[model samples]
Target: MPKRILMDHDGAIDDLLSQLLVLTMPDAELIGVTVTPADCYIEPALESTYKLLQLMGKEEIPLGRGDYYGINAFPSEWRARPEIINALPMLINLPKSPDPYAYPSAPELIIDRLSAAKEKVTVLMTGPCSNLVLALEKAPELKGKIDEIVWMAGAFRTTGNVQTYQHDGSAEWNVFWDPVSSQKLVSYELPLTLIPLDVTNHVPVTKQFLSTLATQIDYKLSNLTGQLWALTLDTIPSYHYTYFMWDILATSYLAMPDYFTTELVKANVSTRPPNAGQTYLDDQGYVVKIATDVNTGYFYDYLLSQFKQ
Candidate 1:
């Protein structure tokens, strides 16, 4: 039986890759997709998600949107760029029309589906924990309905990939964007698993990997994927580093769990200043699975082959 999965993202290359991978995976019944802001701001993230789902002809899958501080869009007063993009920051950009989104918000949609689902629903989180955190807090019943949440967050036993001063270079991009929510979400001790930076940092993308993947994928999606990355890399030079296989590694924990080794750690995100968004070992908190090592070569090979299928 195919796993019923819900994916919430902040719009990055790996987020897109993970989306396409799910769309293509026969074993994945993608129940819905929820968009937040980590890569692009809220509007573009929502826009590109709807567009991608349309392109794949999977419009039946729900796409959720919301308006939260930073989660809705970048903090307006921040000095740096207002948004980032793997598709957005390029595709006509985030428009202000109708607030550009779908109904009931992400958490509502996710809980609604989980409430109705006959089987456990797994949420692949490629962004902050705002959506799940809200769902958990608002609808206490959802905790029993969900299977484990496979998340692409945090950094354990390794240096995070952040470089910006706003993040204090101590945090990973996703967690730092909304640390308080992340910290709170993990505290619930819901069935959760994390594929943190310690493992994902090894799943890097390059021209060679794309070339190989394109050769194996459907011509149209291959072309679209290539063009998407081209547009992103052209606009953001720094993304070359940020644009690694962060989310896919998280998906691996769901689709091919054996490829990655994880640890159940009592960890939490530091919501405070210079260390905000940085993940730390917290023996005092609930234990969540944190991926520590991976079969890197197998992961890449499997993804390439899966695209071909």
Candidate 2:
């Protein structure tokens, strides 16, 4: 039986790539998709998501949005970067598709899906935790309907990639962008698995990998992925060893968990300014499974073979 999945994301290039990964999998039934305004304005994020669904011929899947903003201790620092706004940072080319139908509020859609699915739904989070937080707020009992939350969040035991807060340098982009929601969601004693920067940073996107992925992207929907991969790889300076395809690492773990090692620990998100979104161990925290190490070789091997050849 196919695993029923409901995905929530903030529109970004890597987020799109993560969606494509699930689309390529035969045993994963994408129940729905919800977009958050974390990376860009909700309008652009919606359009990008609709376009991808149309392009991939998955237009029938329900769409939803997480509307209420999470508290960002530092709003100015939380704004989207140029690369993130453009989505495809290095290229001006963007494919077009028909406009999508109106989507319901994410919380409502989530509750409806939870009530309908016979099997507990696997909620995939490639962005901030806003959508899940809202749904849980609206229907706290829905937690029991969820199988697990596979999230690409937190920095954990490593240095963060972005400095959303002050000079603390302790937050990953997803958690930093919306610290309040992150903290709220993580504190819950729900079933959750976190793929933090500690493991993702270890497996970087290299030229050779992109080249191989290029050969597998013959479908029209995947052409944009191929182009973005090519352009991003081309734009990298010679000195760079690998580019971190952040969200995909979490999605990769979803597709293959045997390639990962995890630790069950209690952690919390810092909601204070100059230290927002810093995930750290605290007595007042939630205990969840967090990936600490990865088998990069097997992960790369599995991911490479998954490209539609």
lDDT values of the candidates? 0.72, 0.75
* lDDT against true structure, model 1: 0.72
Q: Which candidate achieves the best lDDT against the true structure?
A: 2
Q: What is the lDDT of residue 5 in candidate 1?
A: 92
lDDT of 1 by residue, 1-309 (tens): 999998888666667767888888878899988877556566656656766676677766877775555422333322122234323423344333234554558878877888889988888898777887887788888888888888888887888766665556667767877888888888888888888888887876678877786675456556565555554443445643545678877876677887778778888778887788888898887788888889988888877666554
Worst 10 residues of 2 by lDDT: 73-82
Q: What's the alpha carbon RMSD for model 2?
A: 4.0
Give per-residue CA lDDT, model 2, range 91-151, as digits (tens): 2345542343456888788888888889989999998888888889988988989999999
lDDT of 1 at 52: 67
lDDT of 2: 0.75
Worst 10 residues of 1 by lDDT: 77-86
Q: After superposition, how far is residue 182 of candidate 1 from its true place, in Å?
A: 0.7
